[model samples]
Structure formats: structure tokens, C-alpha cells
Target: MGACPCGTGRDYDDCCGPLHAGVPAADAQALMRSRYSAYVREDADYLLRSWHRSTRPHALAFDEPRPAWLRLEVLRHVATGPDSAEVEFVARYRIGGGSVVRMRERSRFLREDGNWFYLDAVGG
Candidate 1:
């Protein structure tokens, strides 16, 4: 089995595949991890679905020269309220043979109707 992109030391199917397949994430952190996996897979549909409706973009273009996602390091997760949370993470990726790019962000999430959706990054 292939390893998960989220660096959770788990297989893809056991980690984020179910979430990508329409099973709701258990919490904000889980949703964040699943979203990272979506990016790795270039699954724009899953990305849009996991994004908050109000802030979701109309489309995503995963054209050629796509970054090869390396791994995800979750730094911290905090529950701001019963239905809101934040997750700090660092995702590493590389485009073609270029140096790896590390993207660090503290992202917010909102839970509605028993589902968690990414809102946006705090300052990133």
C-alpha cells in the first residue's frame, strides 16, 4: 500500500482516501490532512468540496509542471470553538527538478452540518 501524503505514518487508504471518497473528516485537523492529500493527488473537485462555500474559488487549474508534493508536517491544532478550529502545518513540494518549497500556514476551518471545511490561512 502506498503511504499517505500527510506523513501520518499510515497508508493512503487508511488515512485520507476515505475522506477523499466522500466520508467526512472527523475534525478540523483531519480535514486539513485530507485537503493536503487532495492537493497531492491534484483532485481539484475534492479541494473545492472541502473548501468553505463562500470562499471557494470557481475553478482550480492543476496544469502541467505541477508540484510533486513531498510531505505534510502538522505543527499544531487548536479548537477555537465548538465549530471552529485552526491547524498549523508545513507542506513540502517540488516542481520538476527544482528545490523543495516549504509552505507554512496556520489555516482556519469551520464545521457545519457535521462537516468541516477549510476557511483560509490566517496570515499566509
Candidate 2:
């Protein structure tokens, strides 16, 4: 298998693949990386499953003209509280041969029942 889309320099099976396959992520940062990999793979089910129920969308639509994920750069991961955390990352992608676009976001996550779920993003 190729390198993990999260840029973790590991095979997908040893990295985010397991998370997408139903294994819970160990931390907020790990969940965030796995989410990025889900997007790269167009795995909407994984994305939805990792989202917090309170804020989860009804559905995820990877419509046409979707950007092809190129790389992920995790900037920082910090615990805001005992069960809350934040992950800041820059994801680079391009749409249909267009120039690369960088999306920088500080995403919040919550842990419930020992499972990490993405809450929302603060800035992008």
C-alpha cells in the first residue's frame, strides 16, 4: 500500500485505515488525521461516523469538481480540557488540474465513551 494520506509516512493499513475500518482513534489528533485520510479516499461514511452526533451533517456529498488531496500538514494538537481537544492542520489539494489550495483549520473534538468525535472547526 502507498503512504497514508495523512502524511504520517506509514502504510495506510498501519495508520488511518484501521480507524476508517471502525477502530477508534487513540487521540484527537489521530482522529483528525484519519478524517483527512477519509476525505482523500472519499469515504463519507467514515467522515460521518467520526463526527459528533450533535453537529454531524445529515449526509456527506462528495460532489463533482472535488479537490484531489495532495498532502496534510498537522501544525499542533492540544488538549483544551479533559475530554476536549484541538487540532490545527493545513491540507493541500487541487481541483481538476487547478493550482493547489491550502486549507488551514483549527478543529475541535470531543471524547465520549472513550471515542473521539470531531465537533467543529474554529477557523479555516
Candidate 3:
């Protein structure tokens, strides 16, 4: 938790730490970054915790060959309210063969229990 999971030039304390530490983020972009961190660390519980139940699967499996996260680029973010938002982003990674892949998607989010949760992927 000491390192910034978002790989941003700031410390965790200045980045996604506040959201993970129970402090609510003011908008969708902040929540999106924290969710990225959750993916990097393979924190399934955290991912589940921050996922909207309606769209969330009963269980999530992260069985892909471990890959290093090269970068996370947030392309755009739009918020409708404290409880609804959308973010478009690309997450790049390098696999064992040194093959790089960029996952680009528009993600939806909703706030529940005063915490923002990932809702679903709305194809871009």
C-alpha cells in the first residue's frame, strides 16, 4: 500500500490511497484510478468490494499469465452524479513473450454505501 498502485508520479498518499483508505473520491476519474490499482495488485477482494453488485459477477477469476503493467492511460472521464459515472481508458501490459497489449474500454461506475464501485464495461 506504500507504493502508488496507479503508477502515477505521486505517492499513494497523494494518489489513490485516500479512496482505498475509506475517503470518498469526488468524481469518477479518482475511483477509476483506484480500481486500476486493485487490478495491478491482483486484489480480488478489493475489486469485488468496489464492483457494483448488479453487474458484478458472482466471482472473478484472474488466471491470465502474469504480466507487468506498462502503463494506464485514462482517455476520458464523465460523471453524471455522485452515484454514476463513466471512464474511458487504456491499460497496457507486457506478457511473457514481451508482447504488449492495450485494453481499451469505457467503464461505468456507481456509488453505493458512500463508496464508488465499478459497474460494467460499456463497449467503446
Candidate 4:
């Protein structure tokens, strides 16, 4: 890919690519970025894999008219503990040829076995 879908201003291979390829994320923010890239790439497998086991879904199915991811803005990243953290972000995307929609969320993450996983949405 040319640029990373996570809006990192970096090449995919130098950014989220490694994480998608099974390399562990360096931190909660890194994992959050990789997860955003996964959505853009429509890589459900990676998305499931990077999710916390307790919350991972049985399967991932994209809608017929998948949202075309536009950009991502990471508002904040805070470590709650040695193995837990949170990320707040806004992601813009559109479905088919529709108006852009902005989604904002604060997400929690947990590190286990030296690998970071998306835990869940912390708040609205």
C-alpha cells in the first residue's frame, strides 16, 4: 500500500503493516492505529485477532456497502496501568456514495502476553 490507512503519514509496511502481519503492537496507541488500518483494509481476521478474547465476536461480516474510511484523528491516549490503557479518536467515513459520517469513541485496551488487544468501547 502507498500510505497507511491510520493517517500516520507513514508507509503501510513501516506502520500498521507489521502489526497486521502478526507482529505485536508496541503500545496501546499502536494497536489502536493498527485496528483502524484493519477496518480500512476490511481485514476482519486481523480485527478479530487483535480484539480481546472475551469480547471477540464469533465472526466478522462487512455490510454490502462498506463504509469507505476517510481519515482518523487520535484525540488522546492514556495508560491506565501497566497493562491497560485507553484511546479516544474520531474516524470519518462514508457508505457507498453518501455523506461523510464522523464516529467518536473512547476505547479500552489490555496487554496480555506482551500483545495488546482492543478490549471494548469505554464510553460514548
- Tens digit of per-residue lDDT, candidate 2, span 1-124: 7899999899999999999999999999999999999999999999999999999999999999899999999999999999999999999999997899999999999999999999999995
Candidate 3 deviant stretches above 4 angstroms? 1-3
Q: Rank order by TM-score, top first?
A: 2, 4, 1, 3
Model 4 TM-score, all chains together: 0.97
Displacement of the residue 87 alpha carbon in candidate 1, Å: 0.3
State each candidate's clash count: 0, 0, 0, 0
Query: Which one wins on lDDT?
Result: 2
Model 3, residue pairs in steric clash: none
Of candidate 1, the 10-residue stretch with the lowest lDDT total is 1-10
For 1-124, candidate 3 gives per-residue lDDT tens digits of 3768676778888887777767777777888888888778777777777778887778877886887877889898988775788999999998888879989999998887677788899886
Candidate 1: the clashing residue pairs are: none
Error of 3 at 5 (Å): 3.2
Better of 2 and 3 by TM-score: 2
Q: Please write out the lDDT profile of model 1 over residues 1-124, one tens digit for every residue.
A: 5998888889999999999999999999999999998898889999999999989999998989889999889999999999999999999999999999999999999999999999999864
Off by over 4 Å in 1: none
Q: By summed lDDT, which 10 consecutive residues of candidate 4 come out lowest?
A: 115-124
The order by descending lDDT is 2, 4, 1, 3
lDDT of 3: 0.81
| Of 2 and 3, the candidate ranking higher by lDDT | 2
